[model samples]
Target: MATDTLNANVLVLNKLWQVVDICSVRRAICLLYLRHAQVVVKEGGAFYTFGFEDWKDFSRNSRGDDFISTINYRLKVPKAIILMLYDRLPPRRVKFTRKNIYLRDNNTCQYCGRKLRTDQLNIDHVIPLSRGGKNTWENVVCSCISCNMRKGNKTLKEAGMRLIRKPRKPDWKTFVKNRFNTSEWESWKDFLDVAYWNVELEEDK
Candidate 1:
């Protein structure tokens, strides 16, 4: 189980310590071998690391479970890695898609402000396509089944509907808030400031 945990996903950090992406254990080990990145060992974890010398002794090492051996080399699966030269920040724009639309709306119907399950939600065009509305982020919203049926082929004013909020492209923070999972990214918490629903904070009282 420990070895499986060791083989779990690894977080990749840029030179500035900002999380840029994730990588597999095999890829992390390759980066370490190529000297492009360094493994990060959490505090109180004995400070072990994967490096060029970890490849020696092949089968003679007693701690084989900590590493993957490739005939002539062996190195521990990386938990997290820091790129030595990757300094660019992540792109500002997020991809546009149905899932993104739901995220932008927080899975709530824009018309009635009702929260519903994903399966019960539908995508609505703020300005009907037949009436000249383009399918861009600024013109689309998450709608409930009832609202969608109620507003079919009609404008909001025409259908006697009001929007809780206007549709617009979400900012980078909001995009990330909807996209990332903190549980799977525990190794990245120290480097990122994203506040997830599952995070625990000190009691104010």
Candidate 2:
């Protein structure tokens, strides 16, 4: 009887696009059952779940137990399932490049903070690569072509240039948007705010 009970509660993950639960080890027994199982939440730290349904319905015509029951007898709450609520970590921060730095800085030259279009931007290494600075998020920024040329292979101090703002990693929301192209991710946007994305940095500071 215990084994039967466990089996009845088991839920599985399905591959079909209409399916919602991705981490479940068991599948809904039938299409009707699948449809009836409400999407409780999206799996991840990100609060992507919205417009989900709950598990109750009533016949419109009857109020005093006159309605016919449509629910299946064997259907049970999903068990052995760890529903993913949100992304556990923020999306990875990409290494800064000329193009990305421009986007992050809104096409503004970091040295002077003057906005420019794509053609006028150049990638500048905060610490010259010759001095063992790795190509990474912290060490790159966008500059105008003239500024970049004047600062070539020289430290900021050497070139007499100063950053208008410190270059740091972007938050998870931006990172995810940059990395993946899908409407599916739109549901999670509200949860990935600047505060949530910068949680780790806040802790470190």
Candidate 3:
């Protein structure tokens, strides 16, 4: 049971309390003991020391031994941790791919403005490659199979088709924000960027 709890997922944060990445509870505990990180107490909203002597003051039943147990001492588990050394936000670079194009277009057909699943969507080159368009982010967008077939190889003007929205490359922030549901990550919610939540991570030092 202790080992299982130690293996649980832990959300890691930068010194500024930004969600940087996730780690195993075991790793989080190690960092706590090593003083590489301190646990953030969400209850009273405080950052608490995780030193060995400090943890020993608390009873096992009060805190829990799964987080730490050695000799006659034990301590509490950390659901979230903040590193002492990191400062900068992680770097983000949006990739060029079919899945990313769907994300950029909000999984909706740009021509008709209807949201659809992956299977129901098609990647259409804004300017067909047959003419002179390259397979670039700006040149492609999400379209339904119907729109793709109707437009065929003709340009929008030629096919009498019009785009409901302009297709553009997704920035790293917006790209990652739309990837998760609004209510899906409660534990990670506060630590994530409020206005622009992206989970891109970089090395601490």
Clash counts for all predictions: 1, 13, 0
Ten consecutive residues with minimal summed lDDT in candidate 1?
196-205
Q: CA shift at 23, candidate 2, in angstroms?
A: 22
Displacement of residue 31 (Cα, Å) in model 3 is 7.6
Residue-level lDDT for 88 in candidate 3: 72
Task: State how far residue 201 of model 2 sits from its true place (Å).
Answer: 10
Give candidate 2's error at residue 180 in angstroms: 14
Residue 157's lDDT within candidate 3 is 92
TM-score for candidate 3 = 0.57
C-alpha lDDT values of all predictions: 0.71, 0.50, 0.71
Better of 2 and 3 by TM-score: 3
Point out the higher-scoring one by lDDT: 1 or 2. Answer: 1
Off by over 4 Å in 2: 1-98, 174-189, 194-205
Give me candidate 2's TM-score against the actual structure: 0.45
Candidate with the larger TM-score of 1 and 2:
1
Model 3 residue 70 CA deviation (Å) reads 20
Give per-model TM-scores.
0.57, 0.45, 0.57
